[model samples]
Target chain A: MSEKTDIGRELDGALQKPKRQLAMVFDLNKCLGCHTCSISCKRQWTRDEGMDNMWWAVVNTQPGKGTPKNWEDMGGGWDEKGEPRPSKIPTRDEFGDAWKFNKEEVFHGGKGKVTYLKPVNTKGESPDWGPNWDEDEGGGEYPNSHFFYLPRICNHCTHPACLEACPRGAIYKRDQDGIVLINDKQCKGFRFCMEACPYKRIYYNHVQDVTQKCIFCFPRVEKGVAPSCARQCPGRLRFVGYLDDEDGPIHKLVHQWKVALPLHEEYGTQPNVYYVPPMSPPAVDSLGKVDPSKPRIPTAYLESLFGPRVKEVLAVLEAEKEKKAKGEASELMDTLIVYKWPEDIFPDFVQDPAEL
Target chain B: MLVKRIDVNGDVLGDPAASVWSTANGETVPLMPTPAAMQPTKYISTKWQNEVYGQTKSVSVKALRNADEIAFRLEWQDPTKNEQRIENTDFPDAVAMQFPLSEDASLFMGGEGTPVNLWYWRADHPARARSDVAHGIGTSRVMDDVSISAQAVHANGRWSVVMRRALSVTKEAASAIQIVPGQTVRTTFAVWEGGNLERAGIKAFSPAWLELEIEA
Candidate 1:
């Protein structure tokens, strides 16, 4: 990792530039919709009271209403001139609730024959949405229906709208690693951060009366281990390392190969987390004839998310896949394949968490 | 407004409904929205543009002091009793009393080297008021030792709250405002209507400080 690099510059001069920036790149093509990252993040950080409904690392199905329901339409982040765009705070019902189950009635209430287990929210109403309420429910007509898993965490943006929105100066990016954090001691729970975050990643802790989000597992990162979400990912789709580490996959995939792109770059926060856009099979016509020109997963939708570079990135990926198919050497293909376990993905953070 | 000196104990002064409160003259303090230009961040300033916040027109206040304690009865009309911070959009109704540490402290929360001490109470935390010291906008810090005690009752489409504290708190004395007998102090007030989603610098506040003369 290179030192003295001015990474994650402030929204204005309100914050000092960081020496280094830790980032993650998710290979969206490899994600299995298994939610290992979400479960790992929950078990590690968000099991407390008032955090029952918060899923810091959520695997959202593309082309579906996200965790907060229509978060895309909610305005936030900076506009073209770096002016803050207005947005409302997402409510509990919008993000869905921590549903309670009738496990007791089904198993031990002696009504097992008739009583069935069902989930109900704190208000005792059936939840209309959840973090994965639209799981596997892809969009499009019969044969062409398609979707991909989009696992999201706090983007840890360089120009963090959340950090800029905090009136109390409670949210800041670390000068060392560029990890954005909320100073719970200083936070008055104004929640302007939630309003300003285009990604809608921050959560309000009602019990503690403060705002909380993904910390990037700083404690584990400082101990030379990757974040729990990355380390525990069963699909090994998450790559973690310093952005300036040219040998690292994060730098190669994002800066060198230029395949990984930030989601919703128009939000203008410069998110640290990037995604290698997913590839899909060709669409089928009404007569069941394969249409090579049209991808099942619409390119327009991906462009709306990762911006117009989706076409270029997809072309490069397809070319590399063809090279590998013909038994030719392809550096990009090898990096994406993860042939060497942790070393291939996160070379700098290969420490086994079990040993720690 | 004079804070009348009474022979009653702290308990009598701490109750908002006490008959002794009737003896003290009530002052109707007019309030206005905190200037959007003075808001701390661009996001807050932008969000406040279309929102109807700080709509509360005025508040009624009565001040009294016993031998060792000072108390104030504040009454404001708010039809909704928003006490819970359970939902993301739920902001509890709150009120604050501000006093300057130095005469130079600006009414806009104070400036550098001129801090203001704030006695803040929220509907959710009704039993105690947080003692905060701030230096300019968005700088309010909750003191290590909370010195103010609060009692509040919501009824008849209005809220009656009593905030009580020692005349002089020796602990964290630097941040705590000292209320001495026979002296006048400059103080201001702010109120937040949770239903309006008003918080931080988006609330109604007294444009100028009110001078309170304490009876010797």
Candidate 2:
């Protein structure tokens, strides 16, 4: 008998197949940039003395300075040689600190402003631009002003740069699910991996002198439960699932419908996480008639990620949104579907041997 | 201290990449050698049965530095003997001839002190050692960088101490120059340090000058 086609074989063995990737999809439009995600994430992983300033998951407002301030500006992921690039070291300010601010003057107002002694960040240090720096501080006057929240975490990558930079071979990615993790016991604290990461998401634990970053909730994920950041989000904007699970939300959001886009795809790390593209109102002249064809998220912004194919992706999303608005497509676009699981959260998972 | 010269002249006994060589010079000269570590990969493994095993060789290197001319004020319990190499009169002459280390003492009170006795290591030499009346030898150094050097002796009477740091540098900050292997690496340093001059744990020799050794 002739061999079955690949698709036919895959169809027959669908239940036996395990997803090779774990990813998250963020709906930037619904993200409040509330530290709830950051706070929940911090409390879960970084509560230790050494892990103090590590905000493995943080939210930054667009058009505002990022966690490492101008993280987008610091260079190092891909080399000019087209070879893999490494991460750069983040300063104490990048991790942020409890800056001494003048509460006395702000309440009293006039006196501090005129005296040139108004509340200011202490020197030899920088001011605390809390996890959320520019939220609600959108530009433009009256009602037309706007800004969006961008919550970020370590993008567990397919070709993880941090993994390559570790000389001690302490950091590793699970072959089964692609979860990036640091082997704390083996880590020598050399921190080369931190410098190699373009995201600047990994942090140095001063007290322990080891390096740490987002683990994609390995323990929870292995049990088939979502991460703390995704589970506790009040906005219900985050979705977590395996990339190969066709029935799962992450698979449908990123591969099936394809609205979710990986941030900075040019880095070529093949980041597992995805984003439900943020939308902004199209630009207009003095009058306020909305342009039907123009997409909310700028095409220029999309180009940075999906490249020339961005127009195609945006077109598809817009079409889906329109169809949903007309009551034709599934109401998925308008509503955030948070999966409710029992107390025993986790997936009945079995890892793959090839990844081992 | 600056590098005096290097002896990167020829072939490494076995694999060329097995080790590196270099040299340096300063207040004290050192004969630095390679870690000289060789693994199975470092040499052509010979097959025993069906498995391959590596051969290893070990060597030791000793370095030499100039010892400060001490006053040799050795006082002992033994009765005065004719074998005494230094006369009691010699110490007075050496002290009188030595430069006066003038210094103001109130530095402890945050006041600037004048120059005084030079900084010196009171450590005893193992091989060339003997106790004085106070159970220690009285030694002194000139207020200048005392030139010192190191040399190595190989197992086969063959020696290879690279011309490490140039011996011309002054002692202050550049005193104990580090010796590293260059292209022509030095072999070992048993001959440089006062070898055969003293025995261990017994000799109470004190160096008026101190030299340091480092590993690469």
Candidate 3:
């Protein structure tokens, strides 16, 4: 199909170039696969009936099926020619509906022995799948098994497929910070955005009849406080800053050092969030000898996600690690280490939420 | 089709199976799926291209109007009553009627400079109907004023809906069809079966416009 169309052009025309774009970078090497970010995000935003299953910030084990199960196979966003790709709205069952435990029957109904604690879905049936159903079930056999935590959130793309797919024009990218948001009042609960977002981050709010997603913690950002997911992360792997700020870690990692790469660049949405490819331990032979030449996690697999730049990025990262290990100064290593908490990372958004 | 005029105190014709509706001839309009090729290109177009949707094939429609208001009774076969939007994927059954603002307006939702007024009713919002205006496909906007009222009932494998509206609405903030006591207007109908996840442009629509004349 032909790439360009008047409709696509018209949608692009409506967007104003933001003065500064807030961006995030997650170092996979440092992630502990903990659900702290997910929990913090849930406590801050998604704590309602329809939002029960929503995990705005999720850490899916790579090489395993991610949340919503095989989301990578679901087509969405723009194709190679910049044409919109078709995608389905993932059902609550596919997303793993929030399970309801039989607390009443187990605790108060005098059937504790028989009922115990059983989880049932909204339809009163045992749930078959959930958000983290494939947790830790990474690829390969036991000897060569490998996995990495892939922390995910809305990329808040420069050319958001969700924004373009909205026929009501309800989704908008803020001109100041390039934060994409769906106007709740204008939204008609159409859910076209959910289908168009390749990352499958947008969620449907059945109660309110509108689509909801990560707001990038705009309320906290406005008060100069880091987002809850980033602020409460125990691994301290997430870095946030304006993409244009030359002094910020985001720019240094994404543009200057070029160590961090956007996931699935082929999706063509221009996702703002980047990832520092994980460097894994060497593969083991049948004799239990470590093969230094073969990384446990295949480079071809990482290339499929982060594009051809994975090899170059990994090489630079390894060189930087070598320098740091030999007691030599490596600005890249120091930035990734993030020794000074919020100050060294989110310099522009340094104010604590409590103080604010 | 002729819309017979009823007196203000005449027997209520809200029920589709009411004896009064027997007097008005029912039109069996053949319905066809809104072509997937014509759906908006952004999302739904590709997802539903090959999927068989809008399985409903036809509907029986009867019309009645009083001196002050107009009413329509639409009946179609539906196995289930999908009244709840409680699930993220659940869609409520719905129906709509379309009228052109001008005589020469395009039948396909009207084009620019030719707008169409639409009265949309959904099973979830059973208490009232919403008023919307469309310049063309994908150009519909819900009007602020909701002057249309509707009630729907599903029983015995069918949905019976009764929708009523005033003859003329104040044009200050809303645009509506000015229903004269004795005037013929062109109209069309569309129905959505929520069980099939039908919404937006994924619907069954009347093949062609039907002419309606109000009794003087």
TM-score of each: 0.97, 0.54, 0.91
Expressed as tens digits, the lDDT of each residue in B1-216 for candidate 2 is: 222222332222111121432122223222121121211111111111122111111212222222211111111111111211111111000000011122222211111222212222111111122111111111221323443221222223322332212322344532222233231111111111112111111122121222233222
Candidate 1, TM-score vs. the true structure? 0.97
lDDT of 1 by residue, A1-356 (tens): 12222254443455456778899999999999998898999999999888999899998998899878889999999999889999989988888788999999999999899979899986788888776788888798978999999999999888899998999999989878889999999999999999999999999999899999999999989888889999998889999998889899998998899999999999988899999999999999888999999999999999999999999999999999999999999999999999998888888888998997
Q: Which stretches in model 3 have alpha-carbon errors above 4 Å?
A: A1-17, B8-11, B30-32, B35-37, B48-57, B77-87, B101-106, B110-115, B155-157, B168-173, B207-209
> lDDT of model 2 at residue B138?
17
Write candidate 3's Cα lDDT for B1-216 as tens digits. Answer: 999987642236555556677777679888899888888654677778888987888888898887787888888999988988866678999998899987787877877888888889899988678888888887777885747877778899898888888776777333577788788878888989888888888899986998989888
Model 1, runs deviating above 4 Å: A1-16
lDDT of each: 0.91, 0.47, 0.85
Q: What TM-score does model 2 achieve against the real structure? A: 0.54
Q: Where does candidate 2 chain A have its weakest 10-residue lDDT segment?
A: A1-10
Best by lDDT: 1
**Pairs with backbone N, CA or C atoms under 3 Å apart (clashes), candidate 3:** none
Task: Tell how far residue A54 is off in model 3, in angstroms.
Answer: 1.3
What pairs collide in candidate 1? none
Cα lDDT of model 2 by residue, A169-190, tens digit? 5788777777889988766454
Candidate DockQ scores, in order: 0.88, 0.02, 0.55
RMSD of each: 2.1, 21.6, 3.6
